[model samples]
Target chain A: MSGNNDYTQIDNLLREDRMPHIWCPGCGLGSVLHSFLTALNKSEVPLDKVSVVSGIGCTGRTAGYVKLDSFHTTHGRAIPFATGLKLANPELKVIVFSGDGDIGSIGGNHLIHAARRNMDLTVICVNNFIYGMTGGQVAPTTPLNARTSTSPYGCFDRPFNLPKLVTAAGATYVARWTAMHVRRLEKAIVEALLKPGFSFVEVIAPCPTQYGRKNRQSTGLAQMDYYKENSIIKHGADTKDVDIDLNGQIVIGKFVDIECPTFYDLQTEILGKTFPHMSKTQAEEASA
Target chain B: MSRDGQLVGEFFMNGDVASAEGAICAGCRFFAGYPITPATEVAERMAERLPEVGGTFIQMEDEIASMAAILGGSWGGVKSMTSTSGPGFSLMMENLGLGAMTETPCVVVNIQRAGPSTGLPTLTQQGDMMQARWGSHGLYGTIAIAPSSPQEMFELTITAFNLSEKYRTPVLIMSDESVGHMSEKVVIPPMEQIEIFPRRKPTVPVDEYLPFKADADLVPPMGNAGEGYRFHVTGLTHDERGYPDMTAEAQDKLVRRLLDKIELNKDDIIILEEDGIDGAEVVVCSYGISARVALLAVKAAREEGIKVGILRLVTVWPFPDQKIKEIAKKIRAFVVPELNAGQVVLEVERCAGGAAETILVPHMGGAVHDPDVILEAIRKGSK
Candidate 1:
């Protein structure tokens, strides 16, 4: 995809005043944001036909920065809000941008449910392991024994394999990529957007200030080094495959890719067959 | 519109059933709720009826999901609602704020039941009166209507939808178990006389519609998820451009307008009915089932040649300050009879000033207040 488009006419859709964003220097959130905008810029998705929704966290701030239809909703409820937006108007490309703490913890239930229903939404979760915005609290996806401000003695809870969870929960498309894999991340987003069901992409982002400081990887460069060295492509890793110690970890690729009936499709099928006039677009398009 | 067309007349149904029918008549295509006592009938009725109307009905995992799904359904461009009581209402407070901040229009029915923590699930209580107004954190305006009977439940439930769309804000239909579970008759209105309000749609082409643009009416036009008018919405304070603005000036401007939409439009929003107050020395003010009890008290007092009146509040949130202030001057005493200890009475005191002496006819929970309890207060006030 070409990097250039009508985006330059706006001189970066980001709020220059809100910049340098609250994300720590060298944090991958900026890159993720860039890649997302580029994806939107490259794809046929109209700027006016997209709604970006986010929950509370550093990554959740993506909605604030993105110059599009965005909703910076309450913590853990962005998925529900996005679901509402999607159901309200299925034609709009509803994407959920949230942090691990917001999605895997407070919003975990919504995440799984939206997936189970095969709701047509693309969820881009920035997994920084710990809750960065709230001063590094131990989150649901925090690795066992990983230290955080809240977990002074290190976290005891096991981390969630987000892609795996969604895959099992019935997401049609599931993929994961680290901050270092910008191209892959962009590709995953493009693929997710093109798919008809719940598409989930868990980006392992670096929170150098909070999650990193406590875990002895305080610098963004250091965190990037960890991703570059530690991640391995298992080719066909299962959602049930657990990562431990990072001692010989093989990071998964596209874990789940299958065709399932999506909420939009089901709605079109049921409502179209029943209330022919109510399916305005479908009837018109069909007749046309 | 002929009055007879709208007059289905009253029949025997519980408050919850009345609310459900009202929702259906209001063009609600989606119903998402969990089964809790008192409010269960609303869900049951919705489940049976929504499917028949070719609408969607889902029993969510919990109250939180129920609230979430309805909010989602509304954005999906369908009118949606949910019902709950005490503990369930408490669970909904967080997402309720989300609905408020996002300016999503949906209906929430809270059938009052006793509680500090699940005090009485099956029995009736008006304890949640205050919680309905200020339960959610942060500053925002809410619309809550109280219904005195199954007839009012049917009527107000529709009114709640109208207000929700007109204001682009969530509206609550407050009822107690007594009204919710009791069997009574209600009339569904016909097309013309029964007013309906739909959310304002963008007319200035999709791209030009700023989702948060404060219009002449103060409500920004709402373009649902699929309408192709992509606009941003956020819980954080945002400018008219729909982008987050965190400055104090921005917060002040945004929050002020959030309150001002209802505040400045009080005449259009506030609903109160005054009875026999022309020369009354004392007045009885009540709402919901208690209002019915207070009416009987006023009638009995009038029979004994006591000058008394009744002010029944239908819209409780804007608080009818002007009406209360005006009535306070002529009436020497004001008696508030409520199913709860004393919730709305405080607002009455605020609005009444010192023009009239205030009295509280408090009922803890369970049974309804007797007319004599309120009548005695009226008799004492007259003496």
Candidate 2:
């Protein structure tokens, strides 16, 4: 970087006025967002045609910090909101950026449904393995035997295998990466953006304040070192084998990539049969 | 008129179906809802009809999703709506607050069923009156219209959209099971005759625009996603620039604006129908099916020389405080007949300010109030 005072390179894509974001120091959201913006720049989509929608969380704040037309919506509602945005104006590129607790726990219903419908959109879930915004509660993705504010003894319930869940629900593209793998994450994001159907990317991030402190890695730097030591990049690995274990290896790579007709494509195909009264102009409108 | 799939002639239809036609004629192009009893027909009609007009329809996983989707659709620059009953309306409360805080314009229809929980599903009652006003929580005000007939359902739905667009808030069409299921003749007016209120757009250039900045009307001009104005909106309390402001001072400004927009323009937004209220000693204050039921009681009481009048509330929110207070001065009593156990009567009693005796004639659920019970209340109230 040329000067500390300058942010001209990324300023076009960021709402710098809303800077000094609320994320704690050592949090990996900044780098995750960096990867996203880099991928956004490389994708060549027009800025005006893009919209970012986020549910309630620390990561949901990404919608506000981004310069694009964005919506910081209610808790656990980002997926359905993005679905509506895409269906209403089929031409706009709707992106859902939120957290594991928001999307995987409370929003789990909407996430699976969107995947099942094969809606065309991209979702980035930053997973820190705890509910960071609400002071580190046990999350749907918290590993068994991990300790949280709510699970002081240990989490007894099994956490979600996000890749297995979404892939089974019919997502066309799925990938996972850690904050340590910025280049790979950026490249995966670009590919997902170009994918035609539901594309999801889970970025295992460092929450120095919450999950890291409970586990051995108390600092964000320690969490990054843990990722460096534990993560294994295995592209095209089966999703069923990607469950995160408390003391085991972290499997990180692109998991599922396939093809299918999107929700809009199928909806447009059955227009005349379902909506028999469609006019000539309306046909083109729905087909958009 | 025919180009947009607007039905331009009269047709016999149920109130639920009439509501769907009204949405189409009012330029609503997107509908998101889940099927529920008493309100399912509205979604069924929209599924078949919205696609005909180039509108989009999606039955979400639940009412919560449905409510969130329509708010999303609204920011996408399309007028959107949803229909549900008591159970679904309860699920939609949180996102309804989201719509209020963000100032997203949309319509919600609740065909009331009786209950504190799921009292009577297939039956009719004028319940959910107070819930429509305060169900979503917070200190914001909402606009709700009561339709007593299928024709009024058609007309008031159009009014709902107009007020929503004009005020930039969620407008509720608080009809109940009886009117929603009852069939009647509804006129589909020509497109030109229908007054359409398009969403107000900010006239400023993109660089110069602040998303939540209010124009002279206190309601800000909204810009859609792809309109080149990169604006951000949130359910969190925000300043005029649409950035989240956690301070109470900022919140004070935001909440006051959300409420004051409707308060300052109450006269333009409220609609009331009154007959013989001027010289009457007793005025029946009612809405929705209760209003229609009161008609019979009012006539019967008038026949007995009680000088009773019917004050039908078309737009029920902002409480019509001034009008009720004014009318209370001339009338000896304001008798309220409702299917719920005294909801809207509370508002009447508060607005009456003890100038007139406000008597509540309540029926629990499953049926309308008998005309005689209301007549008895009228007689008791008149004394």
Lowest lDDT 10-mer window, candidate 1 chain B? B1-10
Best-fitting candidate, scored by lDDT: 2
Please provide, for model 2 over A1-288, each residue's C-alpha lDDT reduced to its tens digit, 9 standing for 90 to 100. Answer: 223533225668888989899999999999999999878877777778999999998999999999889999999999998988887887888999999999999899999999999998899999999999989999999999998999999999899999899999999999999999999999999999989889999999999899989987899999999899999999999999999987568999999999887887777778856666432232367467
Q: Could you report the Cα RMSD, in angstroms, for every candidate shown?
A: 3.5, 2.8
lDDT of 2 by residue, B315-372 (tens): 8897899999999999999999889889999999999999999999989979888989
Give the residue spans of candidate 2 off by over 4 A. Answer: A1-8, A272-288
* Each model's DockQ score: 0.47, 0.74
lDDT of 2 at B263: 90
List clash counts for every candidate, in order. Answer: 18, 0
Q: Which ten residues in a row have the lowest lDDT in candidate 2 chain B?
A: B1-10
Best by TM-score: 2
